[model samples]
Target: MTAWVRGRVQGVGFRWWTRARALELGLTGWAANLRDGRVEVVAEGPRESCEKLLAALRGGDTPGEVEGVVERWSDAKRSMVGFVEK
Candidate 1:
């Protein structure tokens, strides 16, 4: 699954927070800051776990306000080992 998180997502430790969250959920992928001030995240794991992460992302964590979350699902290409901030 790939997600684009908008609104107050850049800086404020958003990438780190997302990395930790994904790791906690045992999801593997990456999160990175976009030029348009959005955060792009790609994660692969159990459907339920991915859903949980999406919920949390939409709800926002500390220091960042999650204005929106847009997601797209696709078939897994390569297996990921750990979540990271890219």
Candidate 2:
């Protein structure tokens, strides 16, 4: 799953928070800051875990304001070891 989050997400530890959540969910992927002030999150794991992470991303419990989130689901391609922030 991939998610592009917009709003007050940059410079607000959103990536770190996302990493923590993803790790806690036993997902392996990364959360990165885009040049356009959005955060892109990628996760590979059980569908339930990925869905949970997506829910949290849009659940209004993040560090900053989340005005919008664009989500996409695709086949996992990476053999990631752990969740990271980039």
Best by lDDT: 2
lDDT, candidate 1, at 52 = 89
Best by TM-score: 2
C-alpha lDDT values of all predictions: 0.89, 0.95
lDDT of 2 by residue, 1-86 (tens): 99999999999989999999999999999999999999999999999999999999999999999999999999998789899888
| Residue range with the least summed lDDT across 10 consecutive positions in model 1 | 58-67
lDDT of 1: 0.89
Q: What is the lDDT of residue 60 in candidate 2?
A: 99
* lDDT by residue for model 1 (1-86), tens: 99999999887899999888899999999999999999999999988899988988987454588888899998877678899898
TM-score of each: 0.93, 0.96
Model 2, position 84, has a per-residue lDDT of 87
How much is the lDDT of residue 4 in candidate 2?
A: 100
Clashes per candidate (backbone, < 3 Å):
0, 0
Off by over 4 Å in 1: none
